[model samples]
Structure formats: C-alpha cells, structure tokens
Target: MLNVLSVLIGLFALLFMIPAFLPFLGIANWLLVPVALFGALIGMLSTRNSGRNFCLLVAAFGALRLFLGGGIF
Candidate 1:
C-alpha cells in the first residue's frame, strides 16, 4: 500500500515537474503547489517505512529535476 502510494506521489511529482522543462511553458510554479500537497498527503497516509521510502522517492525526483535544470519530466 505504501509502495503504491509512493509510486503515485512520485508519478504525480514527475507529472507536475515535467511542464517546467518546456521553453514556452508558463506558470510552471503553480503545479508545484498541488504536487507538494499531494506528496504531503501521501506521506501522511503512509506508514513509517513507507513514508521514508516515499520521501526518498521525492528526493530522487528533486535530484532529477536539478539535473534537468529545473525542467518538467
């Protein structure tokens, strides 16, 4: 269950982050709000082990985003 939740949140975060990569994309910052909220919600719903894994997923994504130069996935 927690792994599923982590996947969901990771997917959503990638979805939300992907738009930032577009050169013409506008308002990319807005997506972060819901992405973060959903991530937090997932975290809240997750157990300790799952929550830590989920956070790691988030961090991996953050690193990816950084590598992408702050662009969407």
Candidate 2:
C-alpha cells in the first residue's frame, strides 16, 4: 500500500512538471518539489529497493525541473 502510494506520488510529481513550462503558470509549479520529496521519503521507508530507486529518480527529476525552471537555486 505504501509502496503503491509512493509510486503514485512519484508519477504525479513527474507529471506536475508539465505546468512549469507554461508562461501563464508561475511559482505554483514549484509546489511539485515538496510532493516529490514526500514520495522520496515514503520510498525510503519501503523495504523494496525498486521503490526507493524509483522515488529517488522522481525526486531528482523534480529537483532538476525546479532548478531549471528558476524555482530553486
């Protein structure tokens, strides 16, 4: 259940990046980083390595987007 939730959160976080590219949407897109981090935390708590790895990848992608989008330094 937790694993499933983590995966869902990671996927959602990945999807959230789409809004960052839109000129109309601004800082609101940065909220996805925290969501990705939450998924990473959940994955870290999981016993399965795959879950942890997927979450880490998602988090990294989110962070990269945030940095490139100028949401973070």
Candidate 1's displacement at residue 64, Å, is: 12
Cα shift from native, residue 43, model 2 (Å):
0.9
lDDT for 67 in candidate 1 is 53
Candidate 2: 10-residue stretch with minimal lDDT:
20-29
**Cα lDDT of model 1 by residue, 28-48, tens digit:** 534554564566566666664
**Most TM-score-accurate candidate:** 2
Residues 1-73, model 2: lDDT tens digits: 6778788887887677667656545365468767877887887787765655676786676566556767743
- Candidate 2 local distance difference test against the native: 0.70
Model 1 Cα shift for residue 17 (angstroms): 1.7
- Tell me the deviation in Å of residue 58 in model 1: 4.9
